[model samples]
Target: MHRTPCTVHGTDDRDVTTVCRCGCGEALPAAPAGGGRAPLYASPACRQRAHRRRRPVAPTTPADPPSVAPLLAQVRELAAVLDAGGRPDPTGVRVVEDLTGRLLARARSRGQTRWLPWVDAAGRERTALDDGDVEALTARLYADGARTVGPPQPSRPACARWVQAWRRDTSPGAQTYAPLELVPGYPLTEVDARVLVQGCRDGGESWASIAARAGVPVAEARTRWG
Candidate 1:
């Protein structure tokens, strides 16, 4: 669609002339013998310039957060579980940690990196993550000291004792890795009984009742399950 030309007053203010929409302040000649709408610009260059100016800018949609977002969210959720003294599936934690680390490394790599290995290995379908998401995840993961992978430090004597107790109380295959040793001066919390509550949920246990039994909020229990 083209714009209809606006008429402007001739030099004597007694006649009318077509004003170029290009703002050149020049008058346009009559449209060719055919009766049609007049052109807007004096020359092709002006028409091109007008077209460029009138072109609709592509609307700026915010980029989606990286595919690592859900993974990082899982990391935060797992960290919360540990913080709350809930024992997580060892295999699950290891898988999440490795995936998060690889994602972080790939984001910083100049070379190509396989993204979200777990998603691929699980044979589950997922939406592809874009460059924007990776950049965002990298910044956030690096900022969060708790999530960043660090060098392994020798377990403190207290942490060691806590681990021994944990082993004694836990049944075979119930325990995975030891609790994080990041809290040096703080006493370790025994794995809460709620850790086993997820099992009961499948046995027709009410969510409210399971949460009460676990001594954790229902939301926390759901987060743990996720």
Candidate 2:
């Protein structure tokens, strides 16, 4: 871990080995880097000992956890059935089982495994996803470890963005919201402008930045809006 690549065989070179690296000075086969890097440590113990001497390089940016929204939704549906004192519908149960298996296989392919959720929820042999297993998967996906018997709470679904309005009144007289691209002299209003600005903020746009683009100073913008 600490020692540099074998001066003779660097990482880019194939099938060659470096020294014991712990300075053991033995000629062992390089670590099992198929065609990648020349091996560095001789054995697990050697690598670990080197690790203790100094930290090994930090790992790369980790992969994001796989989204199991469909699986989570199915689990919730089944849970509702169980709560109602009725056996889970056989079709729905099968769907959850199949979805879980597919998600596990997909995650394995991507090397994005956290292991505990898949292991505990459905195990290697594929059992039904129980409450605890559901919670485990929920925590993994949502990062809220304390939630028990609760489903994962992800952000507002992207479909919300496509919906023209969340307000209740759709009557023509109700003054529906303006589109993002507002044309000049479209009978626009101060209230309408404020609504649009606030909606933009709610949608994660920064008013300060938008104002800056229009050559408005931050202080002046805030004075009018805030």
Candidate 3:
């Protein structure tokens, strides 16, 4: 390690003592009337203090650059598009929005819900609709004795009251079994309200999920809408 000694042109500089090259701030002998080489340091100790050698740091290897495979693939796709000798669809903005919505989900309120999109065994993406695919699935599950559908247990550790909790094969074919909602007091509802029925159906709840939440047979949930 090595360090260069700090120097300042101390000749005729009035503030040389205050701005000492070695940071000592001690006064120096006044420069001779004849201009000459200036004092380089305020004192011998200051000279040693100002000339500390800095340790050499080891050089770090640069990070590897991003892989080029994706970029090359995108360029090849663009070349094929150019070879087609036509511009892409002018109306394809809608497709971009659709794909973006599928790829990036927006934040939703607790009260809001969206329909379930599933990829069946056939590898095609499809939206699950109530009263149709939903009903068919529920009928199949109910017949299979998936009676483990019911309201959530009370949040408190110990309850004087007991509520039946769904505890069985809640698997993929039946979709996810998220406990419908936390019904604090008790599960009470207008037994046969048309608006209520319509609202529940439109709320993206499959009959299977609704039945499990209502603690009823999935068949009963399906027939209730019928």
Candidate 4:
């Protein structure tokens, strides 16, 4: 008598795999020892299918954009205006100076100082404006009725002259003297002349320093002392 192969059934005793379903004379591995449930597979195809069934990832939201661009652009524009050497309104000068200091801080963080010229308002072509100069310009602008919150207009030549006068008078080492002639029209006092001459002597104050202290032009001081 011929014996038939054992049959496998689902855990619930249902037939999940058809027997020789194709009748192709080929046998497939039985599902499970006691049930028709599919066997756990460790093949590449099984892995790929398992990976596809994993939980879908949630999308991410982007961060908010920065808002300082416009302010920085405005600061750059104001800096350009100051760089052009025009007589700026007092209030405008102050604004420029404040903006310049902030911008300079940023530039310095990046290891640069060339931007100083862009914010300078002193019209000193060879050097950048120092803090004292910037403050002076700003104060002068404020005193001249400059609008506090808008683009500043250029001051008139007279206003510019006034600003220049203020700078000259308040500048360090600037002092006036009278009585003796130095330049064709600049008169120096007898005491001032004697002091100036002594200051220029071999071991005395340097002619440059004396000229600076006396507010005399260097060329005139050198000529008179020599």
Candidate 5:
């Protein structure tokens, strides 16, 4: 029998398998022994080519969506308005509207009612105010020349100075007054009388202002000072 140098089969020492020029390809060196197992190439080039064909390239992850920078900027603006201690500007109003919406949503989620405090002239505090109460207070402030319509401007130095004076009078030994209880003959000292006269002479000449400066009720100041 004649044997081919490059082709032989089945367990013979003389059998040799060359790189197959036929390109059906030799069984890879790392190929699993029969029984339907997969083939693995031993040549680096072949392995790399196989890997490129069989393994998938990873898809790139998407970048994070744009941040909450705009919302944060609006919140900062609202804070600035609050810090100024005046009514909010248009931007601030928008922010407040947004916040109010959020708050209402949260309250609805929690099955709760939002309540704000209301103080009465008798020093009683309540959780609600009627239209009448609001109207009365509004009228009173208007009459006193303390209320202004429309947007607030920066506080004037004169108004600020007046506020400072009012604050000073709230301190210990400073004069203070009740608006409704002023009446004549409510005990007055000589010093009190002198202070009352000076207070009247000062810019605090209104009955309420004079009484406040003298540490007496307006009614009392009018009665005694008269």
Candidate 6:
């Protein structure tokens, strides 16, 4: 290849000129007199470097490590939103929960923990809750033996499942199952409680027994049962 510029004598004329893309301040050689695609690199080494830079990167697996502080902070924010909403946002909660679950699972697989300080609502600095706590909370959101009654849907909390069970058991001509009474100190909806009390009476269970089981006086049970 000719290394000299092909310029007419006594004239400042050139075919083409361009800069290299690799941050190296070098001019690419001019193309021939007839028009053609200009070179993108000053040398073969720069061309090879540019090619390597554009190669596809492999997809990352779930076990990839993440920054601990930001992940924890994100989890805390999600938890705070759940708390402040008073009504749960299941999707947001699940997102952070799954993120933390994967992080902890990866740590456990390597037989180590990534320790970071976390502050609780009581303003005490402590380690994050263990898998057991998450398990317990997760269990509380689902009733044992609950199954889909319709097409696929998002998960419902255990309370929702309980209420569904209660409604089905109390419906006229509906097959009965074990009762899922309301939690103490928080009565079921007025209608659900009424149905429950009436169902008990119709089942030949005495008002006194029903009252005792419900942690209420017999008179209150009779009044509600009507």
Best by lDDT: 6
Q: What lDDT does the true structure give each of the candidates?
A: 0.47, 0.47, 0.43, 0.44, 0.44, 0.50
Q: Which pairs of residues collide in model 6?
A: 141-158
Candidate 1 off by > 4 Å: 1-16, 29-38, 61-97, 100-183, 188-226
RMSD of every prediction? 20.4, 26.0, 19.1, 23.8, 24.6, 22.3
User: Deviation in angstroms for 106 in model 6?
Assistant: 51
Q: Point out the higher-scoring one by TM-score: 1 or 6.
A: 1
The reply for model 4, stretches above 4 Å from the true place, is 1-170, 173-195
lDDT of 1 by residue, 129-154 (tens): 33334443343323332221333653
TM-score per candidate, chains pooled: 0.26, 0.21, 0.21, 0.19, 0.16, 0.24
Evaluated with TM-score, which candidate comes out highest?
Answer: 1
Name the lDDT of candidate 5. Answer: 0.44
Which tens-of-lDDT digit does each residue in 1-226 have in candidate 3?
A: 8965444555645454445466566776566579997766767777777776334567998653343334444455555666898565534544444433322222121232322223334445445434324445544334433322334732322221221122122322553322223122234343432233445554455677667644567887677543
What order do you get sorting by lDDT, best first? 6, 1, 2, 5, 4, 3
Between candidates 1 and 5, the one scoring higher on TM-score is 1
- Residue 141's lDDT in candidate 5: 34
* lDDT for each residue of candidate 5 in 63-143, tens digit (9 for 90 to 100): 532433455567778788789896778866786666455444333423311111123344444443233354443443344
Range of the 10 consecutive residues with the lowest summed lDDT in candidate 1:
175-184
Model 6, 1-226: lDDT tens per residue? 8796443322334333466666465677777689888787899999888888899988985642344555676677777876787665687677676666545543432331111112233444443334335344234334333232222553455444544433332322222122334223233467666655555554456877766555567897778656
Q: Candidate 2, 17: how far from true, in Å?
A: 82
Question: Candidate 6: TM-score?
Answer: 0.24
Displacement of residue 55 (Cα, Å) in model 4 is 99
| Candidate 5 C-alpha error for residue 162, in Å | 1.1
